[model samples]
Target: MLPPRWRLAATSVVVVGALGVAALGWWYADGRAAGPLDSVIDDRLISRGEGYEHLLWPLADLGSPPALVLGMVILVVAAVRTHRRPAIVLAALGPPLASLVTELALKPLVGRTHFGGLSLPSGHATSITAQVTVYLLAFAAVGLPRRALLRRALIVAAPLVVLGVSGAMVSLERHYATDTVAGAMVGASVVCALALALDAWNRARSARAARVPLSGQAGRG
Candidate 1:
């Protein structure tokens, strides 16, 4: 069974993180500080690639169009497995929508760019994080059953994928560390916010359905 506080706690964290990232965006908006912070981040990440640039490139592309399509496919498969209709729909639409907001809305609002693209929140990080958030929410919905090997594997692999993608984005200097953090926060916040809203919707429907049966029983009485 899912914990009663899980959604609430997760949603709360998402709110806090999003706000923090937004504050960071304001601080760095329009390339404020002249990228001093980003330069420091770059310096820290520069040598961490360890001559693994080629390998990291593919992993980093997990946030690209092809990888986003793959993530949607995984979500479709997971949605097929789950029972909730709202969740099924959410699994279908949430991640890509989050990615869009990250790229279209958040990026422009922050007004930070890297190499000709708006890049305050790394689009790649946002995409990957949104996908990961969906899987994590799905795992929670399933209650971490011992028999669910595939879900369990996803649980283990999700963070690693995020780490690899985020690391690659930073190591390659595609985005600063702050951008990755902000992107991640945006992705997680959007997904969790949608999930919580839908969960409330599902609960209300269930409650109404239950009341209908009780009201019918009362009429008969």
Candidate 2:
């Protein structure tokens, strides 16, 4: 069962981490720092960033229509499984929702460009996170009962795929460092929150059941 406080704590931590990463990105937006670490990030992301753009462009090319449809299909499939419908739905759509709201609506209206604009949040990263989170949660909801260790391993590994794909996009300049970090926060926060909330609800319901008598005794002698 979910511990409400811990769910809250996890959300809080993700927020804090995103903010920290954003600060670093902002500090280096102008590329002012000089050191081995800066050099490393720049070389991996900034320097060779453009070359890697081709890798993600194909995906971006699918655009909103196809992506949204595909996302919905996946969400539906995950939702139909066992007792994890809510978590799966939230995990599946969280990133895409963030991305769409930010990129299609917020960014244009706010008149922000990818470089200097409030593009600190990345839609691509969010989408990837949502997909990965959904897969992990769905796997957990269905398979954990059968094989605990393997399920745990998959849960651990799934996020890495999300991070790796999103990181590559960031490195390729498809998104600013801040944007990718924000996406990660959105995806992780929503999935964790939903899962915890469901668990807590179930626990509360079970506790209530345990407290109730199986048969009424009002007329007993």
Candidate 3:
């Protein structure tokens, strides 16, 4: 099996590449009409109309402020219970950083207007994606063997939640398919990068600790 760090690194590269591809497509398409790939999925979802709005609305609302607060609470409690400082720090920083990147950087840089405002990477999609990513990372950091089932469940659920939110956004005409796809990629990339950094820090600290005894022996001699 690949080392965890290597796996994380690979995931980061793939996610970043996806984000770049989405951005390039958005930029290259410019003022052109929506391509088949973008329009077809959205068209099918929207065809369901207002009848499905109520169903999707709650799923979409998971990205809202109240949901974010709840997610943060869960993250904090998990990190505290496990006494994982890296996880706690990541929980505190990751979501906000992702949101900032989406709002201040990607959205502005892409400049794709929707309903009179920038909406290249959907804020709702980013919010949900970032929130889920942080929670998963925090949970993993806990490393409770008994919670293996829960972790597996989370691993299965996170992507589904992202897809549900994306579908809701497109169905509601809140974002194009490309926007949600890009948002997912961006959010995943941000969390993956942070996770890899934390892993590297931990590995370096372990190496330093291991060398301390040898260094002490040399000094004593």
Q: Across residues 1-221, which tens digit of lDDT does each residue of candidate 2 receive?
A: 33445456556755775565455445544432233553456456656656566775654433234664686576666566655555555645554665675567534443434555455345665566656555545445445435787777877877676666666755655555555665566556555556556666767887888766543444352
Query: What digit string (tens of lDDT, one per residue) describes model 3 on residues 1-221?
Result: 12575556547754774667466546634433444677788888888756888888898888766776687777767767767777777777777777788889877677776666677677777778887777666664345435788877877888899999888988888878877877777777786677667767878888999999999999999
Q: What is the full ranking by TM-score, best candidate first?
A: 1, 3, 2
Clashing pairs in 2: 120-179, 121-179, 122-179
Per-candidate TM-scores read: 0.90, 0.62, 0.86
Model 1 lDDT, residue 209, Cα: 96
List pairs with backbone clashes in candidate 3: none
TM-score attained by model 3: 0.86
List the candidate 2 regions with Cα displacement exceeding 4 Å. 1-43, 49-53, 59-69, 83-85, 88-113, 141-157, 212-221
Query: Which run of 10 residues does model 1 get worst, by summed lDDT?
Result: 138-147
Q: For model 1, what is the error of residue 216's alpha carbon versus the real structure, in angstroms, after optimal superposition?
A: 1.0
Residue lDDT tens for model 1, 13-50: 67887797879789878873336666776776778786
Model 3 regions more than 4 Å off: 1-6, 9-22, 25-33, 141-145
Best by lDDT: 1
Better of 2 and 3 by lDDT: 3
